[model samples]
Target: MNALSHKIIFFLFKLKLLQPSESTINFWLQSEDTDKLEYAVTQGNYKTRKLAAEALEQLAKPFSIPALLKCINDKVQNVSIACLNALERISTKDELIKTIVKKRFKWVNEIREKREKFEANKGKKYNIYRWERASKKSFDMVKERLKRPIR
Candidate 1:
């Protein structure tokens, strides 16, 4: 983090300046250096990525999807949430959304099932049963309704 970058991060954090215009966001989105923008997506700083994610909605070109998907692995929960929102902004078709949702459902199901088992072992209910059910539904939908294109 450079001095100027640190200053901007601090200022944005302290003032709760959460939204930036499309052009201001483009400054970062279009820059040769993506380190700062990548950092914002992964830093666990909600307000920063909250702004960046909104900007991502507008700055999206073909190159943005993979980078935005990378955010889903962020250690911060909110960053992952923001990445999902950003995906929604970029996805145009039901299939693309469905594909991503299917992937997310797989992840959520694996995680939630393990957590649920752990909770059950400890004689407690889990917080994610609803999500587990939804994941199952999505999985079924993908398996049954998502027919492959005819050759």
Candidate 2:
């Protein structure tokens, strides 16, 4: 391609107006253009996102960990699954991604549906075993205090 067209395409990438093909995404990955791959994981159509996630999984680069974490909740189940697979692969293949997952995303170990369910309920109040807010200690004004310590 001509330099002018390449510059125009690079501009489009910056704008995220271009719907990249799998090859284009692969090229970006090979060239270590992680910003583009991260964008692809979060922005592109389901197919593009799936492919990008798969590529990231194969690459298993630590920097892609945060992007893959964000993509794990993709509305498309397949894409989310791809994101999960990528995260698992990354955790296994890269120590940094692994440490981050263990420290911050332990729930990623759950199955996708279960993870989503857990995440959904994470903020809700539930009456499980021993689940109660501590009540403030109160005193009755009319109640007389013990005169002295009990023998």
In lDDT terms, which candidate is top? 2
lDDT (Cα, tens digit) per residue for candidate 1, span 75-146: 655556667777776776647765885687578668779988888799765676444478888898898866
Per-residue lDDT of 1-151 in model 2, one digit per residue for the tens?
A: 4445544664786687877776676676677767767877888889989988988887878789889989877778788778877887767766765675454344544565697898999999976686444442223322334444567
TM-score for model 2? Answer: 0.55
Residue 150 displacement in candidate 2 (angstroms): 99
Error of 2 at 148 (Å): 99
Model 2 spans with C-alpha error above 4 angstroms = 1-7, 13-16, 93-151
Q: Rate the local accuracy (lDDT) of all candidates.
A: 0.61, 0.73
Question: How much lDDT does candidate 2 score?
Answer: 0.73
Pull out the clashing pairs in model 2. Answer: none
Report the error of model 1 at residue 1, Å.
22
